[model samples]
Target: MKILGIDPGLRVTGFGVIEKQGARLAYIASGTIRTPDGDLPQRLKSILSGVGEVIGTYRPDCAAIEKVFVNVNPQSTLLLGQARGAAICGLVQADLAVAEYTALQVKKAVVGHGKAHKQQVQDMVQRLLSLSGLPGTDAADALGVAICHAHSGDALKALQAFAPALGGKGLRMRGGRLVG
Candidate 1:
């Protein structure tokens, strides 16, 4: 499966593509989509167009996007949401399934801790993807989102394979116990 991950922002949106087969995952490409910080509509248009180009180039099976987390300013958060919406629309238009992950979930999946530092996440991304150097921070975050989705998808597949044997509810204790 090929997955495209997006970290959306008004000024700079990061994107990463990865291919997964069974237990193995390989990085295909990664970069940032930059737009000048003048007009909001223009920026969004640029993001939509750039993301469309990526989808066209890679033809991913699915796309993963990091959900917006507002820390300080509401206005900024709103703008980020708009950018994210544009990205989602672009992917959906390309006929790719879109998955969303929270920043904490992404960090935990990539770095094993929800509060892991940016540098730690970047390091892990490089190591996991076998990249010679770290991608930009935003790009790294995008890759982390993709990695999280890959891991989660793999786990779900494993669970599904064993679900039927466990119980009709898909969660039942076997040998004198209750399993969820």
Candidate 2:
């Protein structure tokens, strides 16, 4: 499966593409979508268009976005939310499934700790992807989002497989878990 991961930001949105085969994940491409400093609406348009172009080029099977966390500045958080919305819209327009992961979830998946430092997450992302050097911080973050989705997807499938044995649903899970 090919997955596109997005770390949405109004000023610089990062994106990474990864292809998963069997138990291995391979990096395809990664970069940041930067918008000029200007009106909010125009910046958002740029993000949407840039992300659309990426989707068209990669045609990924799915997209994983990092969910917004209201950090220090409310204004910045709102802008991030808008960027994330645009990113998701672009993916939907491309007929791709969208998945969201929290910042902590992404960190934990990549670095094995929810509160891991940014450097640690970046280092682990490079190691997991077997890259020679660390990707840009934003790109590494985007890749972490993708890795989180892949890990969560695998766990979900495993849980589904054992759901029936645990007296839950049959082969599929509803509301994120199986119920018999």
Candidate 3:
């Protein structure tokens, strides 16, 4: 399965593609989309188009994106949320299933801790993907999101396989968690 991971920002959005072959993950591509220093509408449009181009190029099976984190400033948080919404719009337009992960969840999945710093995440991403050099901070976070999805996908498959044995308890998983 090929997965596209996105980290959305008004000025710059990061994207990474990874393929899951059985139990192993291989990196395909990683890059950043830089928006012009202009008005907010143009910036939002850039994000939407940039994300759409990525999906068209990679043709990933699914996409995972970082959820917006609340900032101290309400306006900042709202702007971040808009950026995320634009990214998600691109994914949904491509008819792809989208998974949202919080920063804490992504950090824990990649670095084994929610409080890991940016350098740690970049190092871990390099190690996991066997990259020669460290990816940029935003790109590393994007790749980390993909890696997180890969791990969660495996667990979800396992759960689905065993769900039947749970006596048809009406259990189901949505957004990587089990529900009944």
Candidate 4:
């Protein structure tokens, strides 16, 4: 499966593509889209177009994105959410299924800890993907999002596959486990 991951930001959105085969992951591409400073709408347009271009080029089977966290500044958080919305619009326009992950979830998946710093994530991404060098912070985060999905998506599917059976038993999944 090919997965596209996005780390959306108003100024610099990052993207990464990877192919997963069996238990291994191979990096395909990683980069940042820097929107030129100016009007907010234009910058958003750039992000939308950039993401569309990526989907067109990579043609991923699905996509994963980092969810926007509430910032200390409400305005900043709102703008970040807008950027994320633009990215989601692009993905859905291409008919791709999108999964969302929080920064804490991404960090835990990539670095084995939620409190890992950016450098730790970059290093772990490099090691996991067998890259020759570290990716930029933004790109690393995007790749981390993809890596997180690659690790967890199969388990999610497995759990979902049992949903009907569990439902027959008056049970369901909650907090990543079966419950009644």
Top TM-score: which candidate number? 3
Please list the residue runs of candidate 4 whose C-alpha ends up more than 4 Å from where it truly belongs after superposition. Answer: 158-180
Question: lDDT per residue, candidate 4, 32-111, as tens digits?
Answer: 98999999999999999999999989999999999999999999999999999999999999999898889999999999
Candidate 4 total steric clashes = 0
Give stretches of model 2 more than 4 Å off. Answer: 171-180
User: Over the stretch 12-67, how does candidate 1's per-residue lDDT look in tens digits?
Assistant: 99999999988788999999999877888999999999999999998899999999
- The model with the greater TM-score, 3 or 4, is 3
Candidate 1: residue 128 Cα off by (Å)? 0.4
In terms of lDDT, the best-performing candidate is 4
TM-score of 3: 0.95
lDDT value for model 1 = 0.89
Clashing pairs in 4: none
lDDT tens per residue, model 2, 38-65:
9999999999999999988888999999
The lDDT of model 4 is 0.93
Clashes of each: 1, 3, 0, 0
Error of 3 at 84 (Å): 0.5
Off by over 4 Å in 1: 169-180
Clashing pairs in 1: 173-179
